[model samples]
Target: MEIKEKITLDMLTKDSVSVLRQKFITLNGEDVQVGGNVRNDFTNCEDDRKILKEQLSEDYYNAVMAVWEV
Candidate 1:
């Protein structure tokens, strides 16, 4: 069976950034790729992939925590 789905993130709020980033990493690793046209603030496909890999790396916890604060 073939299945498709769409998900959106409301990361505009400061408090949600960490959770959003974590969720983004999880979603990016799945079959779905991040999609949207919010040019000014969205992470492109390449960067998204890189970050996803980084999120699973040995330094993931520290890396994610650091980036989450930015």
Candidate 2:
């Protein structure tokens, strides 16, 4: 059984940053790994990971919010 979930900008907008961070870990941790190494420690690039997550969250939030701009 395969259950696929799509995370959209609207979804991110509804969750707190902490929630989003957890979601990012569950869903995107592998995708964000350097060189796709499953054994790599995320802490090795903690600052980079934080920046990437923040950028993604902010980007999604802005995109969704833009829809309501008058």
Candidate 3:
């Protein structure tokens, strides 16, 4: 599917994790390419990941992780 509409952080909602994941991918993709923990050296962006997981809801963070699989 093609996402033509502009995706903004306003679209993020705790109402649905799956939906949030899709939106997250559309916006942030995966910040997992940098700053990841040494234990999880396979991918970077661990600090960012942790921040999101802490500041934002777990659902959105999980969504970010789902895309990190790529």
lDDT of 1 at 29: 52
lDDT of 2 by residue, 1-70 (tens): 2233334332222222222222222334353212221221222134634643565567554553354333
TM-score of every candidate relative to the true structure? 0.22, 0.25, 0.35
* Model 3 local distance difference test score: 0.38
Clashes of 2: 0
Q: What is the C-alpha lDDT profile of model 3 across 1-70, one tens digit per residue? A: 2343221233333331222122211335632222222221112256655655665466645665666644
Model 2, residue 65: distance off in Å is 1.4
Cα error, residue 9 of model 3, in Å, equals: 5.1
**Backbone clashes per model, in order?**
0, 0, 7
Preferred candidate (TM-score higher): 2 or 3: 3
Query: How many residue pairs in model 1 have overlapping backbones?
Result: 0
For 1-70, candidate 1 gives per-residue lDDT tens digits of 2334332343433232222321122443565434433322334245653554554444543444454454
Residue 64's C-alpha lDDT in candidate 2?
38
lDDT, each prediction: 0.38, 0.34, 0.38
Score residue 41 of candidate 1 by CA lDDT: 34
- Candidate 2 structure lDDT: 0.34
Candidate 1 residues lying further than 4 Å off, grouped into runs, are 17-68
Model 3, residue 64: distance off in Å is 0.9
